[model samples]
Structure formats: structure tokens, C-alpha cells
Target chain A: MRSVRYTPPLWRQWNLVWNFAQRDLKSKFKGSALGWAWSLIVPLATLGIYTVVFSFIFRAEPPDLGNGRDGVFVLFLFAGLTAWTFLASSINGGISGLIGTGALLKKIYFPPYAPVLGAVVAVGVQSLIELGLFLSVLLVLGNVGWSWLLVPVWAAVFTTFTVSLAVIFAVLNVTMRDLAHLVTIALQLLFYATPIIYPLTLVPEHWHSVPLRVLIEWTPFSQFIQVFRGLTYGLDAGSWMSWLTMVAWAALALGIAALVVRRRGGDLGEEL
Target chain B: MSEPAIRVEDLSKVFRLHTERRSSLKEIVVRGRSRRAGSFQALEGVSFEVPRGTTVGLIGHNGSGKSTLLKILAGVYRPTSGGVVVDGRVSALLELGAGFHGELTGRENIYLNGSILGMSRREIESSIQEIIAFAGIGEFIDSPVKVYSSGMYVRLGFAIAVTLDPEILIVDEIIAVGDEEFQRKCFDHLFRLRNQGTTIVLVTHSMGLAAELCDTAVWLDHGHVRAIGPAPEVISEYLGAVNENEALSNDEPGMIRAGLDAVRSGSGEVQVRAVEALDQLGRPLPVVLTNEPLTLRVHFDVKVPVRDVTIGIGFIHENGTGIGGSNTREHGVPIQLEPGVGYIDYTTDRLDLMPANWRMSTAVRSHGHVYDMLEKAFPLPVRSSGGSTEGGAVRIHGRWGAAVQEDSPSTAPSAATP
Candidate 1:
């Protein structure tokens, strides 16, 4: 006998995913006076604090814009913070997506990935707004280039990477309640490790026996930040090595996420 | 013939009862795989088939696996063993507004909930007007659903679900919402859908509703299939078992006569031997028809001689509300009792009860000295003899009339006043 399972094609289910995303976007800023401004205000505030501590207090120098123009420390910091904030928020939001909808899951059956993907898209929209404002600022500064056209490419890559990790963590968080806290702490440490606040040159070439600079350069988050910075702020194409690392990381994470969701997604109703 | 809409083969579901609710990484690491307290078999080897274009009811008490079985069919819960094949699109209203976001407006929730039920944007847009009209919450459609009254919330949820025109619909006790008028509207819509050949699976505690709406019924007890057949037969058997269980649990002389199908509680001095609804010809009536003459015959055994005895019989609606009752004392009639078996007959020319299931409660008392009381002593399945559109518990035979009189100058009151 044929089994009673209805799994519509992923493309057909896009409307459901969009609906979930719309819910996330609207409810996120539902009752605030500032509304969508808070999305920008939050990262901007973080930018302000880091600019004070690192650029002014610690006297850190930023890299040049590569277009015969001097680099402003705040603009340099905002470019990297844009990428970092999107990754952090999307992953964090994705982790709670399944748990928050546990009540709905217990009563109805839909694709479990819809809510998590919706959350990622919601954060992606906020990140897009931040990117638009940052690009406009760069345009005003006359830092535009052909490399700037590659921003969307890097964005698609960045989103894939972010969604993969989000799906993974979100599914894990359903069974392990403490995983969210652990992820929060890990993201905090990752923020400082990615050189978003300080320049990449601040890291020492070597620390005793370890190649500290090379290790940080090869990290997925560091490479993603470098590629985003190159396409927009630097006006230069990222190196092939960085592009390869980003793709490889995204592909690996996507594979694992697909496997995890397939194995555990069907039984989530009982778990919730 | 076409294939059955739903077919279940030896379905079962077992839930692991977590002793400590250990759902954390730390607890799992410390306690390992042996942390399972025990396993509860929620359903076991239950099987049934519902033909296409027919409605089936799952009837059982709480924790009898009815909800679990419905959830399994709805795809919310998977069976631990066996398989079920359901044809066509399925929409499950397991809980009204289950997908609604509190902060989203009613209009927005329609799109969200509709899509969750597998409706396209065009489908939702096309039926949106009908859904809003059915819900009857006009201006509130634009307001956030959190501000809606609970009745409005349920109405909107039900409206969206039914308007989608799903080929197979699964509902669990959601029709018991809203006021009487709204409930009537919902039933009208459901009947319309059923007429259009939509396969429906309903889980309800209302045996009256089950008898009215379902063509077949599956009675489950403690995760096992007790009976499955025509709706009324299965329902009667289920109710009989329920009353029998109630009779067993209560501590009274009722326990001595344990096989009685009704709940008996009182002193053993006098026992109710049997209670039957009879027709005018003195034959046992299987079911009482509304607006027809009927008689209730109560057989009693007077083991000890008693005086000034009053025998009473009351009719109660299936929903547990007492309709109307009368007794010998109220009618100024006293029975002279002795040690012997006797019977009493309560007859009426017309039974004014509406078309629904009613229960009879019989008792024998004397000056507050209770002899015996039988709760839900007899099942009075009152059915309509024809297509009657009347509503409410009792059918009132009233008439409406209109008359017009010719204008007359001499007979006018104004001429007399002048």
C-alpha cells in the first residue's frame, strides 16, 4: 500500500516558506516605535562602541580603500560588522525557530525546515538593508568599482553557509535545551576571533610554534568576512583560495544539515 | 468501486514515558540510554477502512487512543508500527488556529494558515471573501488576532479550514465551539462539504453528533479496537460499556447486581429490575421517534415491604442537562408497597423531545428513604420521523398566522369616537 505522506516539492512549498518568513519579519519589529530602524541601530551601536575602544582608544590603523583614497576606520568596521551580524543573527534565530513552533508542530504537519529557513530569510532581509546603507555610503565616498558587482555572489554564498549552520543548530537545540546557550557563547568568542572590530594586520604572523596568522586566514568566518570586505569596501576581487574555502565550507555544512534534517525531522513532533 | 479513502493496517503507537523529563545533553550523557522509565502503548493493532465520500467517527473516552489515531491519520504523529494509506489532499483541524501568530492580523493569518494547510496563494485569495463572511467577524479581520474574542478566533480558524475544499478532512472536537447559531452554520457547511464527496474523519465525545454525522464508527478502548461497524450500533455498544464501568466503580448495593448496563447506586432493599421504552401496543420500542406516543415501563423488585413509596423518572439530554421530570409524589399519587415484584408505566400521548439521544434516570424513594436510583438507566434514541428543521431540546408545536381585514367606515373606531 502507498504510504500516507505528502511532501510537496520544495519549489511548490516556497509560498509556505515565504509566509513563515513574513511572520518572522513582521513580528520581530511588531510593536516598537522605531520598528525597522532598530535593525540598523543595533549593529550601528555595536560599531560605535568598537570604534571607540579599538580605533580611538587602542589607535588601530585601517587598511587603504585601494582606490587612491584613505580608509575611514568606521567605514572599514561597518563593512565587516554587516557580514558578522547577519551570520550571528540568522544562526541564532534559526536555532529557536523549531522550538518556538513546537506547538504548531504538535498539531499540524508541514515541512519542518520552513520556519528555520524563514528565520534565515528574515535576518537576510535585515542584513540586506544594512548592506544597502553601507553601499550607499561607499558610493558617496567614491569607492565603487566593478568588484562591487560581486557582492551579490558573495551574499548568496554567505546565506547558504549561514542557513546550513542554522538548520544544524536549530535541529540540535530541539533535543538539547542547553545548546542555545552554548551557541551564544561560541558566537561571542567567534566575533572577536574574526577581526571584525580590529584590522586583519593586528594578528601576529606566528605565535611561538603555531602559524597564528595563517590559521586565522583559513577559518571559514575569517574568509567570509575577507571576501565580503573585498567585494564592497576594498573594491577588489577576493583571492581564489578564499572563494574556494567559502564554497567548500558552505557545501560541507549543507550536506550535514540535509542529513540531520532527513534523519530527525520526521520524528520531531514526538520530541516536541 | 473506487478505493477506500483511508485504510489502516495493524496500526500502533508507543510513547516512551520519560521518568525525569531528561531532554538535555548533560542528562543524556550522564544517564545514557537506560533513562527510559517505561513505554506506553497508545494504540495497538487497530485497523479500519473508510470508503471514499463517507464520514467516519472515532469514539472513545479520554486516553483511549482516539486522538492518537486521528493524529496519526493527520500525519502529525507517525505510527510506531503498521501503515496507513490516505488518498487525496488532507486538511487537519487538530486545534483551531494552531498556526496563527498572535501578532499577525486576521487577514495575514489567513494566508499563513492557508498555506500551512497546503493552499496556494490564488486559492486563498479566491476564497478569502467566503472565509471572512463565514467567520462573521467583519471589521476585526484587519485587527491582530490576539485582540479577537475566543469565539471569533475559532470561527475564523474553522472557516479557513473548511473553505479550502480539502479532499480529506480530519477534525478533533472542534465543532463544539461558538454559540448555537454559529454551530448551526458550521454544521451546515460541513454537511455541504460532505455532500460534495469529501472524506471526513471526526473524533468527538458527543455520541449524538457521531450518530448523526458518521456512516461508520470505530470504538476504541485502552488502545484496542473494541468494536467497529455502523455508527449507531458501535456508539450504543460503547455507551453501554461506559455505563457498565461506572456501575462497577461505585460502592453500593449496585455492585451486587454487576451485570446491569446502567449505573445503579442505592440501598439494596429495592432493586430496579429493568427499564424499557414501549410503544402503545405494549411492545419494546428500539428507538423513540420525536412527536410520537411512547411509554416508559419500569420493572421493580420489592424485597422488603415499604410504605408511601414514590417512583420517579427523569429525562436528560445527552449533554447531561436535565430536560423535565415528574414523580408520583408530585402527581399526588402514592404507591402501597409489599414484598413482591411489580412494574410501573409512565405513558404520554406525544413525546415532544427533539431528534437527539436522551437518557432516562429512574428512582424509588419514600420520605427521603432511598430504595434505588439508576443513573442513565435507559437510552432514549429519539429520531425524527421526517425532515424536521426545528432546533433545541424540545419540539414546541406552535403555529404562525396572518390575517387581513377589509376597510369599513361604520366599523372604524374613529366613527365611534366622533
Candidate 2:
């Protein structure tokens, strides 16, 4: 009861988040016939459709790797989609995490951020499974490259931005439920606006649109996808400026989110 | 001598009461201008210290902020202005099984709930078997908790909480659920924990439990600490205040005041307007001692004249045990009824009764038919007059004596003492 800043110890906090993640994952597929196979089904189906449409029907040529493999547009698209799926689902999960667990939070007290962390962790694990499949296919085709080592680094940066946005959206959705729906729509918009499905080079050279270009360049999510692509397919190793911009954007989002949660976290129960 | 386990200084909590819930952005924007209706102050400037290794009871009526105070002590709510200092690991069961995820197995929830209550993984591992045993749901421990019954859920939750072995435990009527055996187990476990130097703060409505279990008691009324002292004294003061309030409300306008009559239900053919208990000297008394002469007067209004109407009066103890009674017809006294206000008195020379609160009732009948009955008219408190210590619903009047007689030949003494 003393006016002290009390928090559970670090290991225990991690355990709590992990326990919740396990519970969420288990319950997600508890009554299903195929169980965890469902996590792989959607992404794989998307990959199959994109491969048939972009490669066969459209006859769009993938960028030349200059190594052995040249025109596998599906592999390149899958690399970027893996990271996007991880970040997108994490952001979406993080946004609804607090509101989803509002019943438990109102009844008892634990660290408010644990649920957001748990949601991120659960989605992260699913994303890893997808990434493993992507890497296995790349290895089977004998196209393994040195640049793939940077996947973890890009993942670290991506997780930072995901956590910040998750915390922000999770807090907002507790008071404003419509924000959850808004965030889902916004994530869909962001997926298309960023260079996940199409290459950044597809932008016309003669276009002088400042806002559109800045949105593509300055957005943390855009940089995350670019960083992931640079590491996986070895097409674009972003310069120091792009790296700094991405790091700055992540730091800014995290700083703002921490401030918001600190100011509004105590009333989470009452608001609910 | 040591520092108290918890010291709360002027603790208060104010809650913003919105006239309508505003969970959406549209509501906030549309009705944003005229929002300042009012707020409710759940607790206001309440202060009490709980010493180490002692059980403190919080007694109050509903909506009296007892649960709010406990939540504040458990750090669930931040006080509006005041502060509290607690000196040990604190665990609170504010809502039983608050952390249980229904999708998880009972065993899994034990670990999850244990960590939520501030236990480490290793600590939960060590106590896992004990917790499972205490829960008593043997195979169901492996099954998801969503399938558990309400009793099983409460039992599992109480078992996990009590086995946490925290230095300080705060409970809010968590044992009020579950079956009687499980409730007894929880109470016994809490009592053992208190004996082992674990400071406990309990919020309960049962004054009997508070007086029997707690070392100190705090009575909360309207968000204020009304009284704080020994358990018996505080409980008595709380019960007295409650009774006084009930009596005042019963005497309010439009509420007919009839003697200990809590239930006024009938066809209303003959209405007993007012009932009173008086002494043999014609003095109305609310309370009388055992073996004291008393009279019960039933005042009624009859709609039509009736003949051979019998008036019966009976005494019932507070524990719902009925004592002996008599009616006018049984005593061969015939009574006539008329359409006017009238009174009938049943008198006793010496009221042989136990030391307890008794309720008096009256009935009107004619020719072995009851016209109307007034059940529980008025309460008469009967106190013992320093005699036998025997316990029962009735007091017996008798004398003890010893008589000697000649022993039979078969029963002659055989052994001798040196």
C-alpha cells in the first residue's frame, strides 16, 4: 500500500506474458480439427494465388538476384509477406488485447502491458513458423544467400515498432472501442500503400507527389518491410539514412506510447 | 510493539459517475459539452491501522465501501488523496478466480493464477501438489476449468489463494460461495494462517463470524469509519445501528406499525391494526426478562360481527423454535366479534422462557375457523435472571433434592478401605 512503484520481477513478468500467450494460442485452436495447421493455411493459400497470378498470368518478371535463381516472383513476395504478416497481426492483436481482456483486468491487478505483450508474442511465434517455411523453400531451391543473416536484426526493429503501436492502440481501444475497427481498416490500407506486394521501383520517376512519397519513406511500417526485403532477397540494402529514419520513427512511437499509457493506465479499470 | 502491518492515512476514493456510459467516440463528441453531472465519493477520509499478525474484520451493510476499502488496501485502486504503507508481501482475493482463464486446465490455471497472485514459477512448482490436493478435484485438474461447476470453481480458487502462504492476506467474502464443507475448510485454513503470524483483513457481513474470529473490528457506514475497537464492541454497535435504522424505516409514513409482524399477508378480513406487549401492571414494555409476568394486547378492526371467535397467542424464539401457546376456544372462553375497533389481552403469570429474543403472534378464529392471523407482531427480548446455566429454548422451574433409602441385601458392601 505504500506509494511505491511496484512491478513484478522481470522473470516473473515474462512468465506471466508467456503463460497468457500459451493460453491464447491453445484456446484459439482448441476445438478445431486441424489445430495449428490452420495458422499455415491462409498464408500458404495467399502465396499460391499470388504465384499463379503474378508469375503465370501477368508474366511479371521478378528482379534478377544475379546469383543462381532469377525469376521466382513468388519467393520474393513471400519474403516480404512473412514480415508483414508478423507485424500486421501483432499490431492488430496488440490493439485489441487490452479490450479483449478487460474483464480480467477490471477484476484484478497485474501489469497492464502484459496482455499486449502476450498478444505480440503469440503472433510472433506464428510468424516465425511462416518464416521458417519461407527459409526452408529458399534453401531447397539452392538460393541461400549471405544477406539472410540480417533477418533477426530486421525482426528486432519490426518488433519495436509493433510493440509501440500495440501499446498505443490497446490503450486507446479500452476507452474507444471503435478505434479497434479503425485500426483494422488502417492496417489493410497500410498493407497496400507500403511496398509489400509491389516493388518500390514501380513508382514512376516523373511523379512529384511529396505527401505520398513521404508516407512511403517516413512510415515506420514501410521501413520495416524495406529492411526485411533488404535482408532476405538481397535487392535493397538501405543506406544509413533509411536505417536512421526507421530507428527514429520506432523511438518516437515508443516514447509517445509510454507517455500515453503512463498517463491513462490507472483509469483502465474505471473506463472499462 | 513492532510497526503495524498496514497504516492507511486519510484514505479516500472518488469515482466519476457518468449519467450514461460513453465507450464510443461518437458519444463523447456529441454529448461532450454537458457532461459534468456529478460523481460519487466511495470513501472519504477513512483511516485505520492493522497491526502485524492480527485479524481485522470490516463489518458494514451493502454499499458501505467495505469492499472498496479492501481493494484499496490490496492496491487495486489508487486512493484519491491519502496514502497507505504496507510492510509485507500482500495477496488479496478480491474476486475469487479473477485470473482463471476458462480455456486452460485447472492445473494450468493453478500456475497462471499463482503467478498472478505474485508467486514465482519455482514457488508454484513447489506448492502444486498441495494446491491440487486442497482443491479436491482429482481428475478434473487436468480438464479445462470452463467445465467446472460453480462450487468447484470457488473451491479451486479458495484453495489456491489460501495455499499461497503470503505474509498478508486480504479476503472479500470469497468464502461466501462454495458448499458448506469447502467453506469450512477455507475458514480453517485462514484461521491457521492467522495463528502462524499472517496478518489478515476480512470483509464480511456476518457479525457472529466477526466477533468469533477477528481480533479487531472496523465498522464502515456511508464511506466513513463509524467505529473501530474490539470485535465484540464494534459488532454490537454495528448491529444496534442497523436495528435502529430498520425500526425508523418501519415507523415511517404509510407503513403500518404492527407488533413484531414482519410479514403482513392475508385476505384482510380482520386486520390487526396495532399489537403491543405489556406487563401485568398494565405497563407496555418492549423487552422483558424470563419468569416475568407479561401481557400481549392485540388491537383489531372487524368488518362484520362474528360469534365464537377464538383469540390465540404464541411465542416463537429468535432461532425459529416455537414454544407452547393456548387459545380462547381451548380454554372454553367464547368471544364475539363486531364491526368496530376492539382489543384482546393474553396474560401470563410467569413467562418461563430462555434468554433470547422472542416474537409474539396473534390469531382470530370463530368456531374452529381462523378469520385472520397476524404473524410476528412484535419482538420481546427475554434475559436470564441468574439461575441455571442449562441451555435450551425453554426455562424449567424445579428444585434439586437428595433422598436416602436402605440398601438391598444383594447390593451390600463387599470391599473395605484401610
Candidate 3:
């Protein structure tokens, strides 16, 4: 006699996603004594190691900032690390998102994409915290300029790219559990393949160097990192072609991932 | 009449059983052929309808497809065949606190669980205090759920579930959690919900609770509907079949019972030859009417000579709750047995048992050791003249009369008259 076909509104579903994202953020460092400070330890140590190795051991000169000032290698590395972590952590968390929320999905019914989106949000927040620290250092060094206004725009572009990849991996991982592990290894390889630890110039300077140069310049990960460094370093910025490449990649990833989710989301509980 | 709240056609579910774990790509590439694993029919052609505003119960043993059916109704698992049409929103408490995180505080978990159940944040905020009050764990709602005891965990989960007030509620054995008082409180809430026109489907092993609460009952045995009808009638039929199964399993060599071959178990030293149920006038009967005096006559024979013999008689409810028993040892009636045929008769003044099926256990022992025992010897059906009062297994006969009280202050001064 009563209708059972009511669908919840999109805003309500988004609120639910927000609640889960909050849980993911709070529970990550729930028991650690140092709390969220623990997250800074690894990146800071990596920055220190890279600065030492490149500046002292390799005797490499730091790059120049926009106003003809020499950029500190650690600051440059920290900028690249923040963008890379945002991209990598979001993908990693998204790949394992459904499996991580297996207990919840098995019992209750909700929008299937909430867990994947929530995981991305958690990592995104953490990346933002790291970005805050990075920006403070840039201000103290007086290296910031008008180009810094594009930081949020860069973050938006990177989030769109990262979340789409995460959703694709997460849905695929449900059917092929090895995909989660395969993705970890693949992302690790992509990290080095893209120019995170080194500048793009590390690749051969020849114009006819098609394969390596294409991977370094045309891939979405490389484009995202280039834009991030452009906003922070305020020089050596990529052309509008790089921004166009990143947006197109994000749209492509989202379209493919959305199709996969529609095909497989309902049956994910059985797979789990 | 209103349309049925749940209409289920020939619903069935099949589960694929993988013979080997082919989760890896290399193994599939190397050794996979058709990839056809075996299949198990967890449910087969289960068809039933639950009318609006009525409580229907599913009663069955373990692995009898009760949980699978409930999951299907709750839309957790898709049916392999047929279909179910539900007219209202369905909520299930399949496993308590399944979505709760151990590290989250109870306050946070409440919102999370509410959102998971499809409630808006505003609705949860409005009903948060009521949920806490129902859970009754003062000051513990602020602590992380990991620190709560098992009882407290289920209490909070149940509290949240019932407060949501879905149109159709399907619960699978969740009431077995928590203490007796909490169980009673949960049942009371369910009863209140039923009164408000909520259609409820309960899957439980407690036949008495089914008989008490449900308007209809479906008995599932081995993924098939064994019987479906009125609650008490179907439960009686199920209990009778269960008793027959126990009788077959308890049958040993050289021990026999009469009137009804129900249950018998023990060595055959002194075999229990037969057991008969009789009315007050001593006429042998297969069934006895409630409130009529009934007698159980146990006939025995001595396969080997036994010295100190004691005879005992007991009544067991169909659900295996022991009612009462009497033994010759407790009565101090010692008998010297040499061998030969003998019978012991245990009579009751009034069979106050409610109208239901029951089992009678008879035994012949020496001192405290059993020489021969007959378990569930007779399948006794106590028929009531009318419907029962629904108190419990037994009915108590007591007089009830009331008189108007005189409003006189001096009446309290007279102890004898008062």
C-alpha cells in the first residue's frame, strides 16, 4: 500500500559521504601519541635526505625562482612531494576503498561511490595540511608571487585526476583482488617515470626523443606535477597546453570509471 | 482488505561454490578451463505473502535458508530466480553493529550508522537522545565503542535500529543478544511497532515466541517450505516432526515404547517395553485434553536381573525446556527387582499444560544409575477447548472475583475483619 521506491537526494548522499570522510580522517591517527604530527615525519625526512644527497653529494646547483633568486633544493623537493603525495595517496586509498569498507557494505545499502569518494577526501585533506606547511616556507623565503593564486585551481585539477583513477582501480580491485597490489606497484613505477624526484630536464634534451619525452610531458601525472611546481616556483611554467592535457585526462578517466562502477557496483558485496 | 506488505513468488537463491581459489591471474591462465564451479541451492521455490499490519515468522533449524530468505527480503542479496514485491521500506537488523567502527566513539557511530541506514543528519540529530535513552548506557555513549562490553554494544545497535521506524522490519535472531531485561524491552518495542501497522518478519528458533507474536508462520527445512499456516498449528506440526526425528535417533537395541514411538535412549539391561497415555478413567489415549487428568503408564521388562530399581517420569516441552520430573528415589520408594514384567503409573490431578504438542520421557534406573531409559516416549497433544491464554507452556487454574470496597476509615483498625 505504501511506496518503497523513494531515492535519496544527491545532497543527502554527499552529506553521508562527508561523514564517512570525517571518520576516515579522525581514525587514521586515533591512537598515536604524536597524532597528526606523525604524518609530517616521513615527508620531512625525505626532503632532508634529497637535499643532502643532491646538494652535498652530487654538488648540484639549485634551480632559479621567478625573481632571479636561487631556489632551495629542499623547498623545490617539498613542492614536488606535496603534489605527488596528493596524487599517489588518493589513488592508493581509492583502490582499496571498497575492500576497506567491506563490513559496512555487506550489512547496509547506500550509494556505492561514497566509500571511494570518502577515501579520496581523507587523503586530500592530509595533502592540504602538508601544502599549508609548504606555502608557509615559501612565504618565509619570499618566493611567492601573483602566480600563487592558481594553487587552489591546481589542487582542483589534481583532485579530479586522482579521484577518477582511484575509483577505476577500486572497482577493478573488487573483481581481481590482485589489482590492488598491481596498482601499488604500478603507481610506484609511475612515480619515478613521471619527474617527481628530478626535474623534467633529466630526460634527454633531444626533440626526436619521442618515447621518454612523451611519457614525461604528455602523461596526466606529469602534467599535474608541472602545474603544481609552476604555481609555487613561479617560473618555468608549462604552457596552456599542459593544463588542457590534464583536464582532458581527468575527463577520460572519470568517464571510464563511471561506466565501470555502473556495471559492477551492485554486485560488489558478493565479491567481498 | 489492504494489499499484502510483502509478496514473494517462487523465490530461490543459488550460490556458486568455487572448488579452488582462482583469485590470481597466473593460476587462472595456467589451470583454468571452463571456470565452472559447483553450485549450491540455498533456497528453492519459497513462496509466501505477508499481509499488511501483521507479523509473520520463519522458524527453522540452522542452515535451513531462513537467513538467506531474510537477506533477500532486505535486498542485501539478489534472488537467483523469481521476485519479491515489497510495498513499503524494508529495514533489517541482520547482524548488530556490522558497520560500527571499534575506534569511533558511540556518539560518532550513531551518526554514521544513521546515515548508513538512509536517515538524514537532521533526523538523526532529532532522535539522538531517544536512541541514547533506549540504549540505557549512561555516560558510556561518549566513550569509544571498543571499550563497551558485548552487551552494551548490542544494546546501542538495537537502540539505533528500532528508533528508525521503517515500514517493514526484518530481524534475524538479534534478540538473543543482551540480557533478559533488554530482550524483554526489545520485544516490547517490536510489539509496539506491530501495533502501529508495521509488517514484521522474524526469523528465530524459539517456537514459543513465534506462537506468541506471529499471526502466521512458515517452517523452512533444508531450503524448502516444510509447512506454512497459522502460527500455532504450523509450530505444532514442526515440533511433532522434530520429535519423530529425535525418536528415530534415540532408538537403540531392545528398548521400546508404545502409544507413540517418540524418543527412547539407554542400555537394554532393563528394557522399557512400552509407554501409554490414559485419561482419568484409565482409558488409553494418544492425545489428552487440557484440564483433564492424564496418566502415563510405563511398562518394563528385565533382560538381566537388577537389584535397587528406581522409576522416573518427566515432561519435556517441545523446545527442550524441562518442565518437571519425579523419581522413586526422591519419593523414597525403594523396590527390589528380580526380573519379570512390571509397570509404573504416574498420574496428574489436572493436565494444566496449554494446548500444544509435548513429549514424555520415562526411565527405569538402579539407585542413581540408569539401567534403561525412554526419552520422549509418548507424543502427547494437549487439546484445549478454546484458544489458549498465551502465558506459557502450562496454565494455572485460579479463581477470580472482585467486590466493591467500603470507603470506611475504621475498617483498617479491625485486623480480623480486614
C-alpha lDDT of residue A262 in model 1:
92
RMSD (Cα, Å) of candidate 3?
6.3
Question: lDDT of each structure?
Answer: 0.84, 0.77, 0.78
Residue A201 of model 3 has an lDDT of: 71
| Number of the predicted model whose DockQ against the real structure is largest | 1
Q: Which ten-residue region of model 3 chain B has the weakest summed lDDT?
A: B250-259
lDDT of 1: 0.84
Instruction: Report per-candidate DockQ.
Output: 0.63, 0.47, 0.45
C-alpha lDDT (0 to 100) for residue B247 of candidate 1: 42
Q: What does candidate 1's lDDT look like per residue over B1-418, in tens digits?
A: 8899899999999998877787787877887844678999999999889999999999999999999999899888889999899888888888878889999999999999998888999999999999999888999999999999999999999889878778888888765587888777777777788899999999988777788888899999999999999988888788767655654654541112223477788886888877666788887565566778888778889888888989998889988999998898998987987888988888988999887778878888989988899877666667654434456899777888875444766554454465
Error of 2 at B345 (Å): 5.0
| Native A-B contact fraction in model 2 | 0.46
Query: What's the TM for chain B in candidate 3?
Result: 0.71
Point out the higher-scoring one by TM-score: 2 or 3: 2
Local lDDT at B349 for model 2: 85
What level of docking quality does candidate 2 show? acceptable
lDDT string, candidate 3, B290-312, tens digits:
77787777787877777778888
**Candidate numbers, best DockQ first, in rank order:** 1, 2, 3
Q: Over the stretch B71-172, how does candidate 2's per-residue lDDT look in tens digits?
A: 777777778889888888888778778778888899989887887777778888988899889888889999999999988898788878877887788887
lDDT of 2 by residue, A1-272 (tens): 54422676556598788877776787788778999999999899988998888778877766755255675788778977888888778778877667777777666667777888889999988999988888787677766666676677667877888888888888888878888888889989988888777777665544565556655755777787777767666545667887787778788888988897888777676676
